[model samples]
Target chain A: MRHLIDISDLTRDETNELIETASDIIVNPDNYTNKCSRKKIATLFYEPSTRTRLSFESAMLDLGGSVIGFSSAQYSSVSKGESVADTVRTVSCFADIIAIRHPKEGAALVAAMNSPVPVINAGDGGHNHPTQTLTDLLTIVREKGRLTDLTIGCCGDLKFGRTVHSLITAMARYSGVRFVLISPDELVIPEYLRNGVLKRENIPYVETRSLDESIAELDILYMTRVQKERFFNEADYVRLKDSYILTPDKLAHAKSDMRILHPLPRVNEISTAIDYDPRAAYFRQVRYGKFIRMALILKLLEEAEE
Target chain B: MIIGSIVNGIVIDHIPAGRGMELYKLMKLNELKCEIALIENAKSEKLGKKDILKIGEMLPFDYSILGYVDSRITINFIENGKRVRKEHPSMPEILSDIIKCKNPRCITTTEQELPHKFRLSDRESLSYRCVYCESKAQSN
Candidate 1:
């Protein structure tokens, strides 16, 4: 009964295998279309996310598996005070696997505790999101042709960006990978992650306020939105919101082959004009997300049989 | 004044007043076959208020149980109306099977088959953390 509650749960080989499987799925989508013909997937999204929910639904539908579950807490029995343990237990009786996304920090772990089937953590509150990490890994592999020997630049809201944290942790395992952390002083990466993962692993990284200066040296540019609600003071939020915006002019300094990535639902962090640029890989990354999810469903179901 | 202390018995002193009965309940002293006397609130210059428990036998007990509630207990081995040995509370080495980790994401908290394990990270601060999730506790 293996569960992916964190990114570290997968070893280096297992991670690569998943990426390879996703690539294979991308090449010949019609060949493995009926892998899970009679299987069922239950998506229990406690938080309202149109993008992630639709991605999971599309992935399951592509695999020929039926999808059934609620998209929000208000529509679920959770609004009537049902515990996560009880809800997962009940859902497991009908579905072969479950994907859960919740606002509480540890709600997915709680569901995994009581679920009879394997539980996949879609996303837990500002905590770890293993699948998004998988998507980012697939993107890096496809774009760069390798995962090592690259300078990855992560800009904006590093302090609260779970995607950035997960990507950094996963990339630290590879060789010759350096990091350029670009953000304002208030939203810089927290000391725990800096000291615990980066410093302890002896990974070379530099903190900078200028994104344009470091953009030319990067092989990957990962941009995240600077959210307003995360700030305690509105004035502080307004002051630093525009500091990390990526416009087409900013792309002039970047390398010709440098790939730009974002976990989308972009709010002016990367201008719409840059969407036409060949360097923007975020939309392609979304398609890769579905391919990898389809691969995941097949692998999990195969493992269940053995 | 529960007569003279018996030879080769354990004496617990300096417990906070009004908590003697609670300590007695915690230790289950009443179930023991040995004679026990629980002294009520007594005025002391150091503690200001204290209680004493005199047991008329060398009972098999671990003094570390007091590490959770309070650290003010003193144990003495009285022999022929004289203190032969004394022991004071020291910080425990490993805290387990006593308190559960509050982090619901912790492997120990989620896995039913796993045992709850924590290590004392800070001795002076009495801080403990779950070995799995790294959630901290002030005292346990």
Candidate 2:
């Protein structure tokens, strides 16, 4: 009955277990090769995503499981007016498990309510992506070897970043976690998240506009693209774009031990020149994404039969 | 102070002053055929000025709604002109098809057929969030 709808669905221990499982997979790939050999994973991606859908497919394949289902709503019966409930009910008969990515929020919940098989929310309209949180956690733990007592500086698009919201929720549970929020005033973190979640939990956090200064103290710097489309004024986008971009000069100011992360598909927000730097964890973050998903798929399927 | 007691009806007492009319409208008290007197600004020992709803007949009412409107309300069931039962409405953990989710990006906004559901998150603050998006419900 358990589904990966939100990052908070898994506790600190459960999240740690996923990180541990992914690490174990990295060491002994052969041990988990046939764990899901006979299982079928149906990916009901209502929205088109290159990384998420392929990551799930890649994970299922790596686990020795078969992958089925559509890439977008236009290709499926959804174009002919099929409800998520109806689609999932029908898919339940065909597949042993489901990983759904939809543009609508709570679309996975609708499918899970109707689905007989185990359901994993790949991504649901910037609402929750537990699997990505798993990937981030695994990367952080692998790079830093610890989860708690670290300063996490989040730069750019804090207001609309689903990853930022989920990470804040997950990291708040751990002790000695401080947040350094760096963003333009227009794109500052939502008050409800700051007040309802962080303030309620009593987690220490500071808001600032300077990424250059904040970089020196952070153990982990999470960068997100602040889209030009989000700005009503073209001038505002041009002014703020350069400030958030991580260049070589900015890297020099940062701690040599600090790790840089991004949920990829960057557009000038991060300088390509910094990719060669040992501290840039974004590209390496992608490969670890597959391993975390493999661990998630294995865990969900294992827990489903129980 | 002597509002006539009902023989076989329910008395909704302890509603805050001036809120009874809103409750009456929300609960659709006008739809009932029985005599319903909305006593506003009634003097009370505990409350200086409270409202009392005196119904003349027994009918099935959704008392669960009272918890949302005003939890301070006490419903008294009068059987044969004698008080039989007195209890407050029970607050629900989850409410469906009641309050609409206001978040523009929420699934319910695009999927019109989906039920507008909210879950009671904090009891002390009476905070309810959209089950789908976790956006706090804006109280009317």
TM-score of chain A of each: 0.97, 0.95
Output the number of the DockQ-best candidate. 2
> What value does the lDDT take at residue A289 in candidate 2?
96
**C-alpha lDDT score of every prediction, in listed order:** 0.83, 0.87
Candidate 2 per-residue lDDT over residues B1-140, each given as its tens digit: 56787898989999988888878876778999989999999998777899999888887766786787667789999999999999888676887776688887677876778898889887788878888888888754
User: In candidate 1 chain A, what residue range of length 10 has the lowest lDDT sum?
Assistant: A103-112
Instruction: Give the per-residue lDDT digits (tens) of candidate 1, residues A97-182.
Output: 88999876566777887887888888876777888889999999999899999999999999878899999999999999999999
Candidates in order, interface RMSD in Å: 5.5, 1.2
User: Which residues of candidate 2, in runs, are more than 4 Å off?
Assistant: A227-243, B1-5, B25-31, B37-52
Best-fitting candidate, scored by lDDT: 2
Q: Which stretches of candidate 1 lie over 4 Å from their true place?
A: A228-236, B1-140
Q: Which one is best on TM-score?
A: 2
Residue B91 C-alpha lDDT in model 1: 57
**TM-score for chain B of all predictions:** 0.67, 0.82
